[model samples]
Target chain A: MDTLINIPTMAELSAKGEQPDILFWVGCAGSYDERAQRITRAFAKILKHVGIKFAVLGTEEACTGDPAKRAGNEFLFQMQAMGNIEVLNGYAIKKIVTACPHCFNTIKNEYPVLGGHYEVIHHTQLIADLIAEGKLVAEGGAFKGKKISFHDPCYLGRGNGVYEAPRKALEQLDADLVELKRCKSNGLCCGAGGAQMFKEPEPGKKDVNVERMEDVLEAKADIVAVGCPFCMTMMNDGVKHVEKEQEITVLDIAEITARANGLL
Target chain B: MLAQIVFTLVFIVAVALFTVQVRKIIRNIRLGKNICRNDRKAERWTTMARVAMGQSKMMVRPVAGLMHLFVYLGFVIINLEVLEIVLDGIFGTHRLFAFMGGFYSFLIGSFEILALLVLLGVLVFLARRLVVRLKRFSGVEMKAWPKSDAIYILLIEVLLMTAFLTMNAADYQLQSRLYGHYIQAGAFPVSQFLSPLLPSSTEALVFIERFCWWFHIIGILAFLNYLPISKHFHILLAFPNTWYSNLNPKGHFSNMQSVSNEVKAMLDPSFTPPPADPDAKFGAKDVVDLNWVQLMNAYTCTECGRCTSVCPANITGKLLSPRKIMMDTRDRLEELGKAKDKNGASYHDGKALLDDYISREEIWACTTCNACVEACPVNIDPLSIILDLRRYAVMEESNVPNSLSAMFANVENNAAPWKYAPADRLNWAQGDWSKE
Candidate 1:
């Protein structure tokens, strides 16, 4: 899993008198969460493999204020949003992509209302697009017959109505992709949405993540695929909760694609 | 002459009671903050037509939807006959619309058919609640008076419709006998079947007709007054609720004004943020903090449990139920309304809707998924209430879950929800992948 490629930063590109085709918004989870870092690297590998001109905002990147807003701190959220908008408007960045559904949703849907507008895309959508254009070929390789189930992230599935792009990315792998009983629009949350990722779940009959994990387990897939880093964390935790960590692996669509393409 | 005088007195009392209830409700709703939803006139009207008038969203469950459509039509269309009843009571006329001949017959016949359908609908609804054991109807929130209120409304409608039919039956019986004051006029086909069941003596028949006529009219008045105190208040509020619905994209949440202004000031070089009011509430601490439309939504809740049934959090055993949120708002609003009525206009007993009615755990459980908003036939936005309350908890009270506190700290200093500084954001792309 050696991802030693030279990653260009926004500052570096500005110094080079050039701009990348897309500004990769490496979200908080992707930037620092150990489990989510793999997703960031995998997506970066796919971007490099496809020869797409992409650059990370690097140190210049800040959160899109999704969690802050969802947590009901509108003041903090707007402060963060305004700061990012200033930097983005300064650089005149046009197209942006991120592997985190939370960031993608905030930037695409919430930012424009705060005076920041860009062509925002999620990484699965990018991978799906690349595969469709035949620019990046996903051969399935070792994953040809593997059982994989995609857990739809709330922001990606219900928030954004993007049930197909992730599936398309998985389809490129030629793996046996399965559906949870409550997939697509009726998909359940992984208990990490609405800023719940930062808070312990309130006392309930059952944790939302454990309940959602039951659906994944019922599907009995060896590999659980996710499109969002938040979903990856929650689903991976769900797998661990049931002590099925040795039997099942939770991964992002980018990781699966990267693995299938021999990049990882 | 004596009977007409008594009818006038009864009418005056009923109207007075109904008017007082309505005025009280309006005043209570006014206690809420103002919001401007008047931007989209055509869309608002269309929403009212489709949701309140057409019951379009109700049809998602065909059996219940069609049944509700029948009951709704019965309640609306049968009221036209009340116009005739009122005129007759005031002017000492028998069957005031009888002069219209065929049209009167047609209207009466249609009313009879609708009444029958309404009776059947009410019966089925009652069965669903009492016998069929629908889980949504028998929840903890719906215990005691909530359950009784629902059953009582259904039974009252049954009684009203039955009284109307009985009065029609007695009138038909008297008309068949060609009694002096009982004109041989108007249609009564459904009641015609019930004419044989009336007492043979014209004296007893007149007594039956007069008793039912008074009962039916008085019951209608009672129902009108009861609406403000009942979940069936939706009967009056749904039209306006649907009309004032937020027509924005379902995923979009309205930005707070104070927050937006501060953000604008931050972005502009020459701009300065407005002076903050020390007494200003951050979000909703009580019903007074919520917008009028949200208060209207509280009144508009039918308590059908459709939103709660589909709520993912509720489905997964979370404490959050959108139905309960609306109910709690209405209950707290009612409590506040009662206090204002009892005490002075400036009354504040220190109880707020936040902890008193709704809890922090319930508000936090919501994912803001808009599932409840989507499921609401009347377009009640429970998510908005949840967000506002959460806003109060986080921004004003500084009382969020410990994990959220950590995330906030990270966002403030590290520019992310994680502990890593912004400079190390690209570490994932740089080194140490071999450790994996």
Candidate 2:
């Protein structure tokens, strides 16, 4: 594994009077959260191994204001949105790929009206497309015959109707892809959306993550794959809650692809 | 002549009262703020055709969908017989459409078959509610009136279909006996089974037929008027509601133009801001603040609880029930409409939808995952109302939960939801992934 991966920032690319093919939007969770960072790295490794030119916004990127918008603070959401739009438009960025469904959803659907229009896609979508093109060959070296189930993220699945892309990426692993009963459009939430990640769940019999984890457990998969950073956190917590961290693994789709393709 | 006069008077009064109630409902819906749902005309029509007219969304649960389709098709097709009934009631003629001969018999045969299907469907629906007690039907919002309203509609439909079949059975027997004005112009495929049960005397058959005819017509009229007040209103409103559905991607929550303008003015000193309306409120506090499409959605809800049942929060025992949000909005709107009717338009009951009807706990408990919106058979958007109510709590009243307050502050200051510094955002990249 490459310990010192050379990642270019948009600022450096702009100073060189050059532009990459895509701007990697390392969302706040992917940037700061310890677990999600592995996903960010795995996805970056895949992009690099496939020779796809991409640049990160580095410190210049801000939250896509999804949480704030969901929390009902339109003012704060717009402020963050406008700030990010200014930076994105300044870079003349045309296409973006992110590992966070919240960022993917916000920039793809919500930013056009604020004068920030660009083609935004989730990392799983990019991985799926790359696999379709035969750019990243999946040998399923480590994950061969493993039972894996993909958890649908709210913003990515029901919110935007991109259910097939993540599944397609996972399909490349050549693993026994088990499905949770509540998958696809009917998938359950991880209790972290709409800014619920920032607050305690108002009195409930079971945490939303625990309820969702029950579906994962019933599916009896060895590894539960996820597409979004928030799902990563919630599903990981759920695995820990059930003390199945040793038996059941929670891996992001990109991480699985990275391992299966021998990229990491 | 006396029977014609009495029937016409009852029909006129029923229609007039129905018109009055429908107009009031339209007025209540119009009380909401205007929105431009007219942009995608072609797509809107297609959606209406597929969802409402075609009953596509109802088919998500095949059994319920098929049953609903049976009842719906029966109600619409059988109502054609009502046209003949109205003409006969007015002109005092018997079986006026009998002039069409065999074609008329074919039509009545189809109506009889459809009426039987409707009866069977209604009984199953009643059993689902009362006997099976589906968890969706027993939601907290389904208490009292909502629960009973569903049962009443099914029972009424049962009665109407039964009366229709009995009227046909009595008429068939009378026609067989060649009684006065009982022409052999109709077919009774399903009701033929009932023909043997009628009395053999011609006079008794005439009395039974005439009494059933009168009962069926009056029941239909009463059912028509009851629609504007009951959840049965979905029968009429579903078409328009599906037509006005949000055609954009489901993830898209509309940008508040009012907030965008204010933010632009704050950021760019050179930008000239439009003059603000003094009456502008930040978000929805009551029904009037919501868009007319949302208000129509409230009226279109059939209290199916499909939304609440699928809600992740509700499933996990959180207070957020999307169906309840719609119910509360409709209930509050009805209350306001009544108050306005009694005392001029300015009347305020001082009870708003936010804290009074839908509590902060309920709205805050929402994950805004759009599950409810997706599950709605009629495309009702309870999430929009929940978001708008949350906006009222956050912007208008600054009454957010303590946890979200910190998140709001952090987003405003740190550019992220957490307390992490902006510079540390790139630190994740510098880590030694080889160690793992």
Candidate 3:
């Protein structure tokens, strides 16, 4: 296993009598799912490169309970949500940045109703803010002139309406940033939302991810840039379905930025 | 005198029939669970004005919107003349509002013009369904009674408008001959064209006028009763449905209170959580588990297929059709309603909306995208019903798809929907930090 460096947990920071600028919410997918773990690392590298003080919850972190809630397991969802909120409140966490749309959506929109209110932002927004503030610089390295089409994740695009931040982060790559036909508000789901990601699709004429992949193919881009980890999985599977895995690559916006900025 | 007596009997019978049907509909709608949407009176009224009264959302497609607006306005405004017609029938008078003189002329002339417009509107609507075969209207759900019901409504409108115009034409001809109680008070510009072709004899003119007059009144009553069973129930229910629409952000889902209480017990340090109720259901399992507003929504759907046309799931060839969801709810409710009537208050059909009316495939196919809710001009929410049913499948029945089972297990065991433990969450952060 590749060892991570210079990361601190809430407990470790408290033991050192210090606090970071922001709490990095390494969501379950980003923590465990191998492909998504790269996205987590890419975003963390950006924060480190920019010299922003950030800390993760380490063993104290739990799932944000989004999948449980959406899957209709209210009992399980509440159990998970309350557990995370208790730990968050214990750390007196204020600002949180997450790489997962599922976590961002649940904590930002849902947690407040359960009395766990805090400033929550997706990593794209944080990176975009960092760029705008001149704290970090991005450049078009390997991606210059590359045709990159963005796949808007439901939780990020329609659910929360943060359509531009990821695109803005992509603009730093100086790539041909193309949009799918069903872009922005009308963008289709990757057949992975509503807990559908965890199960086989009900028999249908076509899988929703394959249908959405048609849009990605229609964009005729070399790279399918995504924000959410689930979308990354769905789109990657879609590319492989068409035997175009070698031609098309699915990269999180953070991963692309980290690579372009030579922080990898 | 015999004519007046017969008219009174017809009116009494027609109204009683219509009243019974409406009561049955209200009772069926009340079978669903209660949800309080009475707050925000000002916002609700504004929504009614904009959506129902102004017909704003319909204007998204201008051609259909304008055509529908004509039919809607003609139906509501022309009914004002029904009041005068009923009075004339009851009291043995002719053109009862004729005493209002010039104002009566304006009202009569307006009704004549509107009658022609309504006739034109229904004809175009019929042609669209029968000739043009709009894809939305031709979908599988529209194959049987739904197809015939639409044609029937348009055909009825055509007949009703024809009867109205024929009555006006006969009255005009009778007025020209100075027939009994036929006054030359109101202008009938459109029907006047037909006045010349009518028989010149006074009694014959009176006979034609009387037949049409009786037919028009009876037809109107039948149409009112037919509305309870037809998709045209939207004519009566749209106003309330639009007024009761959720004003929250489109993506916001209603949190279950049962879940909230448990979360509170966990979050608040001093408070102890109550033991889980053994019989407490997590989400909707049947029609009765759904809120009254959702039931009202099912009743209000026009079956216009606007929602299905815009749905990503439907368009992408998924089994899910938002329109089908609404139709299935309405059908199930009607089934339950009839059983209640037949069984004299102890009715159990031993069937439900889930699996029987709507399939697990249909509910699972939806992305919960809210496109259907946005597309519905009447603000009928199909997404809510789908979510509730999915909740039943996952929580109550434990019949979720295998992949979802795996994901749920991950969430239960690892605080997320992945198989990773909490300690390694930041493993991705480990790399050369100062090399850059």
Candidate 4:
């Protein structure tokens, strides 16, 4: 935890006439939300620990227009998209990684049409790859024998067909990875997607996150692992809503891997 | 010869009525905005084959899948016998294809078996709807008509299959008795069991056979006409619906080219703007505003409610039911079609799909999770229609919830959904992990 990690911005790297291996897209929630910031740090720490050269956009990073697009402001979404694409294309960035599924989805899938194309990947996919490459040796330090359920982020799982990468990262933890009744392609949304995190849920019998929490509790999982920052916030709020924060813990897959590897 | 002439007239009328109804549906679908889904012909064929013909998506629920497969196969295979019926009716020949010998026997035997399977499938479907009462069948949108429509189709299948088997049974009895024109032609595996139930009188058997033959053929023709108005139209539309599926990654919502052009002009001084049509709208306000594929999706939806069952908004008790969205679209389209027919093409009902049929509450409740899209067996994209409605609501009407308005303002001014400064974006990296 006390290890010195070198963090460089894309501007700093460009100033030195050097380019990192990848540009880490720290999304709006990752940059602004306190809880999501921890996930961003954990993922960055993993990248640093694995000796992967990566740089952050820092002040140059803006919203990927996911919320605006989903919330029905196509004009606003395009403006934001064009701005981010210009910055990215200017950097001549070839590959990108993000802890947020929304950013990963937008940049990887949606941005190409607007003249910005990069080999975008989610943080979990990168961790899975690192583990596969033996660059990151994940040991089950605290999570061993504990029942961990992975909550699929809508954009990452159903939206983008990435179901296994996060689970692969969890598999290395040597924990009992129990699946929620609805997992993978059928995975339920955590209610924070489609910009719902910004607004109160339209009145219903229960909040969508609260409904998803029931799935986790039904599995009797001691820990709920997530891949997206939005899901992280929603699942955490769900735990609080159920007053099970004392018994059940919610952590992002990056944070879990970071903890299990004793990097945090 | 007189009987053949009367049969030909009846067949012509049935086919003509069916053609008229189908043409109306096509016209209604064409009323929608044009979208190019014809790209990737090879992929579309594969999708149609896999999703519609192969019932690939149906396998999500094994019980319903298998039952549906039985009915679907039976319905398709047994319909081949209709060709012989049509030929015989035109030429005044009994078992016109009976000269094919063993192959004809094999075909008749297969049809008999398929008819039995169709009966079993229809019964199970009825039981699922009436007795077990599957949750997918019962929704707020499933009122008297929708519920009965399902039952009626199942019951119609039962009656049709019964008439076919009864016709075969009488034919079998007459053939065994060596009655006139009742030639020993085709095999009857299933109807052989029913031959025992018939009377020994040859004339009575012939009368029974003739009655069932007319009934079965007329029922099938009536069923053909019934398809355009019924939810059962999916039997035909599912193929094209799956073919023209939104093949992009489910996460990738389509970018509006019109909005893109306007945004480019705003951002770049050198960018040229296209001459705008005064009537151009941001997104769908009514059925006519939706893309043709989306309109076909409305026609393709059989009210299975698989989309609603998997929808997070619907599952958590929100008002958004994706099945209802498709149903409402189809209903509004039908209403508009009828209005146009009456009012000569410039019909205005003053009601749009957005407010009148689909509510603002239902529209706002969606999380855009694509669960409904993933759940649809025929690849019906209720999410696309929902998103289009959302676009209209936000872009044209500027109608949004208070919280979303604030989020929009933040994204507009501060470059994030929250009120945080862009300068503080890198603050997360400065966090002292050493404190832990």
Candidate 5:
């Protein structure tokens, strides 16, 4: 089973022995963000299928306090971060892996202030690794036959500079990709973030997801694939209201990859 | 005499109302707490001079910029004519500086030429709004009673200028008032050449000048005082707001302070606990709910619509509009300010973070992308406010999206916002690292 946190101090890490090959850190987004769990499960299953021996983490993990801090509760975030670091210290974990882009960014970028420092990579990079190793061969050239679109989650592409990894992973999966007009640095918000998933958006002239879905529809793709869980929920909700029975499906990169590997 | 007295009283009343209205609008924005507050005094002044005063924002579009420039410059130049009327009222002389005929005539001619240019400029602005309807230029266009008031104010100024020029050449007596001046000495060239045919007396010209002058100055002053309530309030307050605008590092996140600064607190790995800080501050949830500076920004918007134009979420047709953000802040601040004054306390219970003023989705929908600020000519950073609100949602309320919760957990445990840990943190860098 994967652990929930990262070991920030070297003393705790040294006590346990040399840090494990990877400290598997499962974030709040992954555990509770419905699509994230499905995507993460697919990524794990795919890696396992291809003979990769990665440790599982965060089958039981607490929130990182990003939402608390963002919502103006800095004190809570600090408490949560400290508690999470203790969980990692017990295992002497130094290196880490994450499926959530926001988690990847926060741990890689934020936890250093809390005395947590470790190498972290998104699952997309791991998939890129799997592709590079030639351990798993792609089965179908037919996968690229139809057009597909990718949504860039803010934390993944802009916050962490991991723009190309996911796209490369998609290319490896042989997806015939179409892109929204605003991608990469100018990505659209899916309207499901910053605790927006917990509460309804204020009623206004339009829903942010509805606006973003219009872009996917404008791109005219057969399937809309996203890397982030929030993007999946928002795009799904947006399409549900606007294009019922429209035959367009929303899938995460991991799920898509799992399908490509004939594991789905 | 009775007619003049009645008109004077009417003009005074109009100006008073205009002044009252303008004050009210500004007061409302200050009271709402939607402004960005930080150590930004220098930014406020510099941006006000560079962006607002220089009309740098208007220049983003060439044609609109040019038209606005004319109106702005014309309004200043027209002030000379207004001063001339004030003097005539006191001295009872139709001629502006009649003692210096040569200079007075030249000044009059120059002002007339400038007024004509202003008319032409105003025409372009009207056409853009009504005829061209440029996408970038479009906004929540004011209409109905407000529109009528706006038109009424503009028309009065235009008519006074037109009539002044006509009386100069077309009015026989006023034409003689210029006497022998060097610049365009011939009255026939201007419309007032025929003024001698009407009432060729000094008293008649004086009477006419006062009539036109009152219509122009009184109308504008009246409008000015009433501006607080009117949509045109931006003209008065945009300067101070722009001058004090945040000029700090763009997209700079507040340094996250540590409440539990102990690294050893987590070494044993057995506990998951919330903070025991009984008096800890959570995220910003309302007005008076914000620090002084974020509240100040609500007061400074020029309403030039630049933020909305650059907003990616807005361009995508999201309900989030930056322009509306400022407007709603102004609206709510006014509401709260009144209550604060009335009750000696803030009306909201620390959660003034109202959906009615600024929608919750609009607040969270922002990706901390900084596009709105980058596009703002006045340099109002909307991203900071968005992040501040996010902090409140996550920390105080403990109501965050599952996505962020996942991110928080991953970063805390594995140093990544992911559920499934990668066996290798840098899987792509592995081969490169070994070779290096």
Candidate 6:
């Protein structure tokens, strides 16, 4: 028995509306993580504020088999992915937007191997677009007083090459931003990916999250904003564990954007 | 004279085995034995070259690269000494060109100095393994592990170096005895150092020469016998493996061998043709599941641990240690040969198919990341084997995880990996981009 999580393709989804053509994917990470949900709704609000018609994928949104495939459980990945293909096939889906980097990467890079070709886009890409379009103008706006920095989730940055989108979105908001020394392609894993969200980290050196948190504190940024749900969960949990020394807030990039728009 | 005879036989045997293996590899190809991938053969060969000879993977970690470069160069240069020793045994003299002495002397001297440097390099390598404590297989400390192959090679190098030094000391004593007798050439630094200590007898020099010669020759012979079994075996296998590598682009996979051309009228149209096996009943499940050249990789592996050291899954602490996957297969193969009927491997209790041979999680952990395949120096294609097993698991066994289950259905039914309205196939190109 297979349960299908079907999300429409970007093009079919994009044709549903007009400008702010966001091709959003309901990543498995988003399905489970609260932070990811917050960020996206905020991003959606901001995009709406900027007059972008974000077409939704309807019932077609599902897991993109990245975790299942990477986890070496191709059967589960395929079953879940089939549901997606069927849904996308039912609609002329176009232009994708998703909060999770894993989803972004999978739908973008891996979908073609299985024949699910689409011009996929992450939510950050749309935010970057909205900002570039001068529609979601947040410059010297919402988040002006908050000192923040971005965590390039592996799936988003290194996994799919969205290295600049998340930063650009924040720049559009004119948030006080700082960069971690180890950012971009060299970005460290939150140690919570590839269904690692469910497994325990090996008992060796430091927790990868804490290690990453220390890097954020070292960057001296007050808030650590991320686009990936897993990163947010790990970083937020890590903040509580290491909160005695520094007061660091771990928010999803969407949440940061939402705050910029005074939406959430 | 006894040493000379033994040396010749050992050399002959080693060379013979190496050539036969290489030649059989071509025959094996003609017979289409280890065609283990769906990727183009040319592509696989290219990956092998770029990884093996080009050392593309080694550059990932700088320290490891420098260490391997020295070790690889040492093996190449030390080979000259092996040839020299063999020549000495046959000709009753160590020098190949005796009358033309000056250049020859310089060549041997330079070799000895280089060998000395390599010997020192060996020490540094040992120190790194023992002191630096690199994690090789599954976070296991390599230094503490019983690396029989590496340990033995290091021992041989030390023994050879010691033998050379001792023979030099004794040879100097004898050479000084003839210092005045053969004073035609200008003084040599090495000989001059031993001049005062030499006893005035050419017999002593000859005796010491013969003694050092015996140790060096014996060491070479012993190493030859171990070539097919030891980690250093890549020394013999690397040359040909690199030379005949599947040279193709990285992105392409070998085309699957179409079974319709090979098999005739079948017993059952629905039998699925058994996935291209001649015996159809006996199928490969592991490294021994491989043909000779692949199994040959067992001996060919330098065990530089370069594959394991750089594997993305391994670094991420997944169960698929590419090095372990190779070493385990080699170990299992050896176990099979040693078994009473060469079939004593406990495939089931070992979870031979999935969990034990390679953990399901470990196998799944591969992002299909070519990091390990790209990292191996001797051209071992772990990725190919992994994918092959995946194929078996997917097509025949239907053992894929639930995630892929949906995708497979989507592929077979919808003809696309993602869900879309069948009528709206052209929607991807219709998206508006300027609305932001």
- Candidate 5: docking tier: incorrect
Question: What is residue B91's positional error in candidate 1, in angstroms?
Answer: 3.1
Report the lDDT tens digits of candidate 6 across residue range B88-111. 777656445444567655655655
- DockQ scores of all models, one per candidate: 0.48, 0.77, 0.38, 0.73, 0.12, 0.07
For candidate 1, write residues A73-108 as lDDT tens digits: 998898888899989988899999999888888888
Would you list the clashing residue pairs of candidate 3? A4-B430, A5-B430, A63-B415, A198-B403, A198-B404, A199-B403, A199-B404
Per-residue lDDT of model 3, residues B314-362, tens digit only: 8777778899999999899999989889987667888999988898788
Residue lDDT tens for model 4, B1-436: 9999999999999999999999999999999988998899999999999999999999999988988998999888887899989989899999999889999999999999988988888888899988999988898999988888998899999999999999999999999989899999999999999999998899889999999999999999999999998999999999889989999999999988899889999999899988887888998899999999999999999998999999999988889999999999999999999999999898788888999999999988999999999999999999899999999999999999999999999999999999999999888877467433
Residue B54, model 2: Cα distance from true site in angstroms? 1.2
RMSD of each: 3.5, 1.2, 4.1, 1.3, 9.6, 8.4
Candidate 4 vs. truth: CA RMSD? 1.3
lDDT of each: 0.86, 0.91, 0.85, 0.92, 0.61, 0.58
TM-score of chain A of 4: 0.97
DockQ of model 4 vs. true complex: 0.73
Candidate order by DockQ, decreasing, is 2, 4, 1, 3, 5, 6
Q: lDDT, candidate 4, residue A30?
A: 93
Worst 10 residues of 4 chain B by lDDT: B427-436
True contacts kept of each: 0.59, 0.83, 0.51, 0.81, 0.20, 0.01
lDDT of 1 by residue, B302-334 (tens): 899988887768877778899999999988999
- Residue-level lDDT of model 2, residues B168-233, one tens digit each, is 998998888787778788899999899898888888888888888998999999999999989999
Local lDDT at B165 for model 5: 61
Clashing pairs in 2: none
Q: Please state the interface RMSD for every predicted structure, separated by commas.
A: 2.7, 1.5, 3.5, 1.7, 9.5, 11.0
> Which candidate achieves the best DockQ against the true structure?
2
Span of ten consecutive residues with least summed lDDT in model 2 chain A: A1-10
Residue B23 Cα positional deviation in candidate 6, in Å, after optimal superposition: 10
Ranking by lDDT: 4, 2, 1, 3, 5, 6
Model 5 misplaced stretches (Cα beyond 4 Å)? A1-264, B1-45, B87-110, B132-173, B177-208, B254-281, B291-296, B338-353, B381-389, B400-402, B405-414, B422-436
* Candidate 5 structure quality by residue, lDDT tens digits, B175-271: 4555332123322334444454555566666566456555565655655654565445556555666766655433224554433432234544564
